[model samples]
Target chain A: MMGDNEEILQQAADWRALGKGVALATVVSTWGSSPRPVGAKLALEQEGAFIGSVSGGCVEGAVIEEGLKAIADGKPRLLSFGVSNDRAWEVGLACGGKIQVFVERVE
Target chain B: MKLGFLQKALAASREGRPAVLATNLTNGLQTFIEATETAGDLTLDAAALQAIRKAVTEDRNATIETADGPVFIEVFNPRLRCVIVGAVHIAQPLARMAALTGYLVTVVDPRTAFASDARFPDVVLSTDWPDEAMEKLKPNRRTAVVTLTHDPKLDDPALSVALRSDAFYIGALGSKKTHAARCKRLQALGFNEEELARIHGPVGLDIGAISPAEIAIAIMAQITQVLRAEPQSDREAA
Candidate 1:
């Protein structure tokens, strides 16, 4: 299929098969005016490489950081990010929304 | 990330079967659930398995809570399919539009003159009889069947098979009188009123579509509406 879901999962599977550490970040839930809907995915590798997007460009850098850490620790983490007034401009979540992303190492 | 499970799930995706991959967020334990399985103990309790099955059926991903922990149920639904049982002028635009909407489109007709690969570029062309071709295609719930040929020989057989299958949308191109006659013929062949209700006879929304392209657009819009809206039977019950 042309959708990004299969492609992202296939990428993680391929990276895992190649013995490269991989972490998957999925937008499990969203609130208010999130950029991407729930079930959006962002995949990351051990070397800070990534494909797909969970929040378009708003929180990718932070997600990438969490993804790399998840790959290192092997413990899954649920990350929450929102467009708060103080950090809204800094994180670029101008959509005025919040999202919960579940990041886990692809075992 | 069991290689065997991943491989099987990939194969399922390729083969157009709905599958669910339930992964334990706490421990990374994973297992695959086929469509036919009754949510049995596949590393998940009954409730979580039901949720996964529901997500797979709805073609969406869901997170389920269970005794173990939160499990992310990743749903791998097959691509939506549009099986057009004619290769007329309308079929041209219809096939293209269906493809643009992310549907794997197939145009079937025995007429070599119209069902040419040149006419329907980038669409699966089946030059077999409509019934035989559809049998091979195996229209599922994710499939929408549309019959454009006015000939009963072509359209009826396709509709017969499509009505028997799990195709979500079945539309036949004809006028009100033509559709009434077609319904009578189908009723003579033993189809009941409720089953016949599934077919959108004067196919497409009442858009006053004149040209073949416009008619195709109307049909596509109706298909999309039916797909996104609640099921007619469900809505009626509600």
Candidate 2:
């Protein structure tokens, strides 16, 4: 079987080949005891189909929302989540760690 | 994040080529960096490229601050490999355990009766002589070589080849006295003390393992320690 990251990229490429909008989100950096390490990936298609993850489910919903926006706008975005941010609490990043995610459209 | 770059990254992963994907945060520009080639539009300076190469070699991913901006470098390295130079009973469990730990494993033995497919399911079996098999394997820094056969005719040639290669771990199974005699013979073959010292004879951590299965466990544990522990000096100090 292919590794998780390889599967994610392969899925994203397959989605793009099918003419579906695809976006890839990566855990670019982390601070404290982040659940996922840097280089973890989450690939999302326009209709909300997803593969892999950048967090331990706490921030994946928010990341998928941002990924959809990136797919729509053709603009890449860097998102940060931490206990210090109020949105982090709303998104349930209750692990007391911080993570930066880079979301980009797979053109 | 171009499709071409993604395809290239997939190819590198499948081909077991070490590579790095550097994505610039400022402009969303990206580049795929391999040892001999690169792709994408992002232009990296000498320092940044050097850092990327370092990360690839160390099998690490990091976000680096460069003059252009913050670039996230994601490294992809090939899987580790373990080559067992015997198809003995101990090799069965060791091969399974090593495979579970994510090492690509190969078992080598010239005896067709012992290295049969029924004995080793889902494993790459080599019915070639130890020296010929070791030559074909060409053990590298990511490889671990272990000689389970106590026969010097088989194990000696494999050990000699392993010592000459960059394999991160080299082990031989035998009693202490047997290992001493083996060392003496290898020394006669011109392997100096330093080179021969690299062989972990008596082959496992000094656990009082009696059964073949238990011995396999002990050997696996020692291999894990050598692979994951700090550098030799720090470990010796500890």
Candidate 3:
């Protein structure tokens, strides 16, 4: 099997070549007992297709929502999720950790 | 996050070269950093570039605080490789364990009887002579070379090539006396004292290992220790 990062990036490139909008989300930083390490990635297509991961299914839904926005606006976003934030609870990131994800459109 | 930079990073990974993608959070600008070149829209100052280069050499991903903002530097290093110069009993287990640990393992031996598919089910086997195989492999900083033939004709030539390469680890299977004799022979061929010291003769951590499989475990542990040791700059500063 191909490495996860390579596979995700390759898929993103393929999607872009097909005239589909794609956004890439990367975990830039983490604190406490984070589920995924820093530099983990999650790629999303405009049609709601996604690959790779930035968390243990705790914050991916929120990240994908932000990724979709990025794809639509062609603007990058930095999202912070932590137990201290009410949004984190809403997003179910109650794993006693915090993560910062950078979402950007694949230009 | 430009497509061009992503493709460049992918190409570098495919070629087994180290690379880094530095993203400026403030402006969404990015730069791709390779060993001898830099590309992309983001221009970095000397200090930032120096920090990125250090991160690349150390194989670390970091978010550095720059005046512009937090720039996340994602390092992409080549996968580790293990080149076994013999297909002995120890090699069988060693190869399997190395592959399990994510190493691209290759076993080199001219003796088809020893390097047969039955002996190494899923491992890459090279039937070339020891020296020739070493020449083709060209072991580098991400590679470990181990000679286990216990035959001077096969192991010695391979050791000669491995010693001259940039391989991170070099090991030879032998006892103290045998290693001493081997060192003498290598010295006669113009290897310096420091170069000879690079080889882990008697090849494994001293765990009192007795069986071939146990010895393989010890060697694998030793290799991991070497691989995860302090980065060069930290070791030098210490």
**Candidate closest to the true structure, highest DockQ:** 2
TM-scores for every predicted model: 0.77, 0.80, 0.75
Residues B1-238 of candidate 3 have per-residue lDDT tens digits of 8898888877877688888999998789998888778888887888888888887776777889888888988987776889998899999999989987778899999999999999999999999999999999999988999999999999999999999999999999999999999999999999999999999989999999999999999899889888766643343332
Candidate 1 C-alpha error for residue B141, in Å: 1.7
Best by TM-score: 2
Candidate with more favorable, higher DockQ: 1 or 3: 3
Q: Across residues B1-238, which tens digit of lDDT does each residue of candidate 1 receive?
A: 4555656666777688777777776666777777665332347767876787688666766677788887878777787899999899999999998987868889999999999988977788999999999999999888999999999999999999998999999999999999999999999999999999999989999998999989999999999898866643332332
Model 1 chain B worst lDDT run, 10 consecutive residues: B229-238
Error of 1 at A90 (Å): 4.2
* Cα-based lDDT for every prediction: 0.82, 0.88, 0.88
Q: In order, what fnat does every candidate score? A: 0.18, 0.52, 0.41
Q: Model 3's chain B TM-score?
A: 0.86
Q: TM-score: which is higher, 1 or 3? A: 1
Q: Can you write out model 3's per-residue Cα lDDT over A1-107, one digit (the tens) per residue?
A: 11357778889999999999999999888777777777788899999899989999999999999999999999999998888877855875767778899999999
Query: Candidate 2, residues A20-66: lDDT per residue as tens digits?
Result: 99999999888776777778899999999999988889999999999
Specify the CAPRI tier of model 2: acceptable
Q: What is the per-candidate TM-score for chain B? A: 0.82, 0.89, 0.86
For model 1, how does the per-residue alpha-carbon lDDT over A26-69 read when each residue is reduced to its tens digit? 88766677777666788888998888899869889988998899
Rank all candidate structures by their DockQ, best first, as comma-separated numbers: 2, 3, 1
Candidate ranking under TM-score, highest first, comes to 2, 1, 3
